[model samples]
Target: MAVSAIATPVAASSGSFLISPNVGLMLWTLILFGISMFVLWKLAFPRISEALDRRQRAIEESIDAAERTREESRELLEEYRERLREARSQAEEIIERARRTAEVHERDTQAEAQARREQLMEQTRREIATETRRAIDEIRREVADLTVMATEKVTRKTLTEEDQRRLVEEALGELDFSALAPAREE
Candidate 1:
């Protein structure tokens, strides 16, 4: 009935933006639309929807893989940073240890030098003392010999061994031996 109403043209012209449909034409158009809808539902629509679903899943999986890769890269970066920090700290510790070792070596070297200097000084002092004793003994011998010669000249006779020994003893007794020797600290 609606198709018949649209197909019947009005004798009076109305100011409306409408076109009348022909009855036979509207009936054939409906038949063609139904056939096309049936064919698409049976074959084309199912394949198109399946393809769209597969494409959507593929896109989602790609996004997930990208996210995983980004997370792994972040973890690697943090690990590398930690290793760098450790290496720097270890280097600092090694440098500090080397400095401490150098300090110890310097102190040991200085102490050893000082000890060697003291030992050398002591040895020199001992050598001087020995030389002084030898010089003093030589001088005493010379004085004793001169005194014996003078006594023999004065008496106008050669002095015997006994007389020479007695004269040397008297001269040695008169002198202070302690005063000629070096003073000891201890």
Candidate 2:
């Protein structure tokens, strides 16, 4: 019926009311638009705006939480890196200390070996000197015995112990026995 009423006016006017404006229709359209806008503002607009505000708050909170988490992770990474660097430095120090200890040990060992070798050489020299003195004494005794026997044969008689001793001493004094001994090294 309302469509017929609107159509009747267009039929009577013979010109479209959309082309030539109708004051009554324009007034009713304005009233209806205002009422609809008022209803939406009171009901739908508040709900939509509240939903949009909730979504914005949620997104901002999520972003802030993510930023905090990122900062914490960065700090943890830096701490891990620092610990690694300290570990590497400690390892290097340990290696260096070990090397120094080994070097010191080697030097001490070499010194001890050298000292032992020198001691052995000195002992050998002392033994050689003792043996040389013993041999010279034995040779002197043999020469003294031979001289007494030769004198007994030449004189056709045994001599007294005092005379034999004097002859052996004179013979020993005339002999240069130092050349027969081994040479000493400095």
Candidate 3:
């Protein structure tokens, strides 16, 4: 029994006293596994879960805010487009109205000018006709007197007043002077 005890294996040596046997290694492994489980349950698992939850909430909030901002911007763009269209229509209408007004004024001015020109022409024509009549009457009287005097000189006879008048009137009637005259004056 003493020899068998001496031959039995032992992890510790008589000279080196730092470690003992396989039981200590088993105890260390069990203790390390227990501590790892405690850390995961008490600190690591909860912190990881909390971080995941916070990240999910932040992503959701960001998406909602982005959607809201996009909608507001779209509405503003639509409003601006409508206003621009309305202003363009109004500007076109104003321009058309101004063009119509100018045409009307131009027509009125032309009509007035034509009427004034017609009036002036008519007045000038009347003055010309009056002057021509006066000229013809003066020429007729002078020619009548001249013809009577020439008859008296050629016949060498003193004629009666009625004879002289008739001869002079007949000679004046033979020469027509009424067809060659201007119808208007300046």
Candidate 4:
């Protein structure tokens, strides 16, 4: 019994909370602590936590910038569209003004041409009436001379001054001098 007690003194010490230096438990404890630290730093802390934080911040910034740019682009497009509409209205107004001016110009030119034609036609008619009157007078003088000669030949008698004048007047009474035809000089 005394020899068994001496041999089992190490076992008896194990029953206490203290451990011996001769056991390899210290090495196991160090290995487990190193592995837990490695897992925390390499897998848990750096990969999931920091990367998630960076990604979330980046996404938020990108969304904000995209919204601002979209608003700016929309405003610019609206401004350009307004300018286009204004230009179209201005162009239409210009065309209408030009059309009105052209119509006025055409009317003025046509009136001028019509006035000129009327003046020329009236002047030509007046000239024709004057020429007809002069021609009728000349023809009457020639016919009277021939009649006097014929009368002297046929009657074998010379007419007196009063009879010749009366005969010539009677012959001219049948003709209208105002409406006489133009004389052709032979």
Query: What would the per-residue lDDT of candidate 4 be over residues 31-128, giving only the tens digit for each residue?
Result: 99999999998889987888899999999999999999999999999999999999999999999999999999999999999999999987887788
Pitting candidate 1 against candidate 2, the one with the higher TM-score is: 1
> Which lDDT values do the candidates have, in the order given?
0.87, 0.90, 0.82, 0.82
Give the alpha carbon lDDT tens digit for every residue of 65-125 in model 1: 9999999999999999999999999999999999999999999999999999999999999
Worst 10 residues of 3 by lDDT: 11-20
Poorly placed runs, candidate 3 (over 4 Å): 1-42, 125-186
TM-score order of candidates, best first? Answer: 1, 2, 3, 4
Which candidate leads in TM-score?
1
- Candidate 1 vs candidate 3, TM-score winner: 1
**Candidate 2: how large is its RMSD?**
7.1
**Better by lDDT, candidate 3 or 1:** 1
TM-score of 2: 0.59
Pairs of colliding residues, candidate 1: none
Count steric clashes of candidate 3. Answer: 0
**Clash statistics: count for each candidate:** 0, 0, 0, 0
